[model samples]
Target: MTRTSAVSLIRSRTLSDVAEYAYAATAPAGSRLIFLAGACPLDEHGGTVAVGDYAGQAARAVANLRTALADAGASVEDVISTRVLVASARQEDLVAAWQVVRDAFGDHDVPSTLMGVTVLGYADQLVEIEAVAAVLDEPQPEGAACPPSA
Candidate 1:
């Protein structure tokens, strides 16, 4: 079966030297939007994982993000935009986290914002990922009545 996503990424022709990401994204009407909570690098017991390691925390954060997306009936491919938070002043730390997230999305790179923050919610939490996704259902037959919300 063929697969489709609701988000359409937009690129600018004049900004060619920009990073490997879309400048913007749009979700058409009838698409179900999923706004996800920030995914943190926490373990099963609610404790932060990979303390003091940016890359390790980033990888865990990405994994948590995938799980959150699945629970929301979406995936990384359906993500329209993302905001990655790294608790550090160093660009290297941000890059370490960003590289993991960027590699996870691969070619379906959607619009993203990477930021450095002074702190995070959990103790020793080095990385967090917040995302918005859209789930699209096939268009109903023309003029068909809409289904009731659950």
Candidate 2:
């Protein structure tokens, strides 16, 4: 069976380093796209895991994002884009959170936006992230029956 992988698109004028976040993404046909809600620092017990610490909160949020993708039969490699939000607009805080995000994404080079905000949904929550992934469907053998969609 054959499957198509996601493609990252870049414009000629853009910096090559921006491959870390392609200006656009193209998913293969018949791919199953998953849109995840923003993930916070909530622990297994549904309580906030890291309070006041941006880096710690970022790590927990990234972990939660992985869990969410796994639940949808996806993985970090399938991610196409991500939006990262930090409670403070400070560069240091954004850097702290971005480091954790980079660690989580590894070499995948998924497109991402890192921004600072005045507040978040949960009180004391320093970081949150939302992601979109494309899980490609394997090509069925010729004449095989098609699988039903969920």
Candidate 3:
């Protein structure tokens, strides 16, 4: 069996989550690391979840990240870091969006950063997110691709 851990690193209020910083850097040797491409606001059907809706987009992004993590043999608890990009200059909206992610990740840990981007891959997308997870296992299967679309 493999053991994993997470930690928090940021400390800010107002615009910050109550939990501040978090991380999951303690993994035994031979542990594998998974890097997932940024996930946008697209849903399983390849349709935008909530056009111009930052909070909705943020939730969808987290869901996609969770799926990818599971497929890669990791879990939300294994995540060590995350980068979130919101396509807007409104700091208040961004904070609300971040709250959605904070709720999804629960007590799991990871150091996370949020950014305000001018745009994303699609005009309908309001947010995009990427993550890094550490798992106790051999390397992932070579040439493995993302799970086939359902």
- Global CA lDDT computed for model 1: 0.91
lDDT of 2 by residue, 1-150 (tens): 433455454444555754455666668777889999999999888788778888999999989999998787678888888999998979999989998998888877677899999999876788999999998766689999987544
Stretches > 4 Å off in candidate 1: 138-150
Candidate 3 ranges with C-alpha deviation above 4 Å: 1-19, 23-26, 138-150
Residue 86 local lDDT, model 3:
88
Candidate 2 clash pair list: none
**TM-score of candidate 3 against the unseen true structure:** 0.77
Q: Give the Å error, residue 35, model 1.
A: 0.4
Clashes of each: 0, 0, 12
Any residue pairs clashing in model 1, and if so which?
Answer: none
lDDT tens string, model 1, 1-150?
565888898988888746879999999898999888999999988999898999999999899999988877678999999999999999999999999999999988899999999999998888999999998866679999875543
lDDT of 3 by residue, 34-112 (tens): 7889977787778889887789999989988888887877788888788989888999978878989888877664678
Q: Rank the candidates by lDDT, best first.
A: 1, 2, 3
**Each prediction's whole-model lDDT (CA):** 0.91, 0.83, 0.76
Question: Global CA lDDT of candidate 3, please?
Answer: 0.76
State every prediction's TM-score relative to the real structure.
0.89, 0.82, 0.77
Model 1 TM-score is 0.89
